[model samples]
Target: MTVTAEREPAQVATLDPAAIAREASPEALSGTSRTPALLIEHLSKRFVVGRKRKPVTAVHHVSIRIERGEIYGILGANGSGKSTLIRLVSTLLTLDEGRVAVFGHDIEREEMRVKRLINRVSVDAAFFKKLSPWENLVYAARLYGLEAGPAQREAVRILSRLGIKESRMSRPVEQMSRGMQQKVAIARALLTSPALLLLDEPTTGLDPRSKLDVQTFIEELRADHDATIVLTTHDLDEAERLCDRIALLNDGRVVAEGTAAELKTQVVRDHGGAATLENVFMTYTGRSLDEDVEEESDDAE
Candidate 1:
């Protein structure tokens, strides 16, 4: 299981549905606010590797503002702090020097509120391998205090949209393809109808058709559910296809950011590379996108 830090500065947000309903107002729960969905100010994190050795700085003074209802992409190799940034925002890891706000609510001061507003789907999602997708999602809904009947109906609706047949939903999750499992992970995360969705390498190991299905669902979520998504991915094409804007991270810092067109234009104007997102990433990071990060082990934390 993924072990988040036990003690942060504030009370951890209770994921129980009753607690969430009691804490959030109608407008806040609706996710239709003028404030940005996410705000990170001068964020930083460091991990001590060994005795008498220098601490590894995983994230360094990164500041970002994501407007409501936008799909923002964070592109990086394995350990360029992409996951670290997401962890911090999701309150998995404590910050060393920064402030994160979700929809104007401080993550530290209003953790419960923040939790009510956002949900995260990691690339390595965990589930009961022997259990069926429906069972797993029903358990999740119960944890979040949802009614079983309504939750099952919603789960079936969502799974069907993601291309999971009713027959397949009854089979063990381990029997399904990785892409199918990933779709189940996404469906489970949406049980609460969170306003801000954090997707970390969402389509990493899917087949072509499955990738398209998941991508289409992401787009639909934004259009129909009023979700503001922060997505991290290794696929440049996926980023270009799904994101409204992109930020390229290198060695724990943002090297460049803009729309796909703007980034391609910047690379051509400044670095004389081909007008493409690949070239933009390569020019800014001084390495090919296919190359793994120099600090790969940091992701295990």
Candidate 2:
């Protein structure tokens, strides 16, 4: 693997007063007065690959806490372990080290409770190709113990909000465009008002318009449903727009974590010039967000 690092100075920018107040007041966001909706303490995961017997440490000892209704973003390049972190919290993969909890319920000790409180939507969401969006959603609802009548009603409502036409709801999911299918996947995750939602590259492979639609829907979900969201994305603009706080991951460790302005300020202070989140990623990870090691290797050969 090739590694590079850039240094930049941090600059401070003022945030709107309303934005500051909204973040400070939890009740203004999440409706419930409960403990933090999600918390991960020193979570870590590793994988072994290749004939040479190399261990790939996907997630290092990382810690994060999200208050109910906060939209936290994990920003990194591909293979920087964003998806692995999401999988660990969602219980799709066992943690090689550390612990995760949802609403104070230990993920390891109270697996069922943690599972019920969280839902994860990945880029490669699986669906019965032959099944219509309505059918897929209904099946998901049933699995979540939601009744058919209410579930169907919610499916239509949420899908419509996501810009999926009412007529398209009954068509085969496989027949829909990738963007439409992604919307349906999101709708499925929302079928039961999960207190915490994990979205892994929810807007990847989308057209610009579709990307905006998904971003808007995510904001709406948090605003209307009071859902705390944890999403991983390679899109820096998306991260800047949607995240209350962003954690930059490089080589399986959190190299930086803060609000956008704070991180930018760090770059300016440390590196001696104006800085942005893009600069922060470049400085710590030593590669453009648009570039990856595999691509570089291919180009070199």
Candidate that would win on lDDT: 1
* Model 1 clashing-pair count: 0
Off by over 4 Å in 2: 1-34, 293-301
Q: Tell me the lDDT of model 2 at 273.
A: 59
Q: Write the per-residue lDDT of candidate 2 for residues 93-138, one digit (tens) a residue.
A: 9988898877667888888767766788898767998999888888
TM-scores of all predicted structures = 0.86, 0.85
Model 1 alpha-carbon drift over 4 Å, by segment: 1-33, 51-53, 293-301
State in Å the error of residue 29, model 1: 9.2
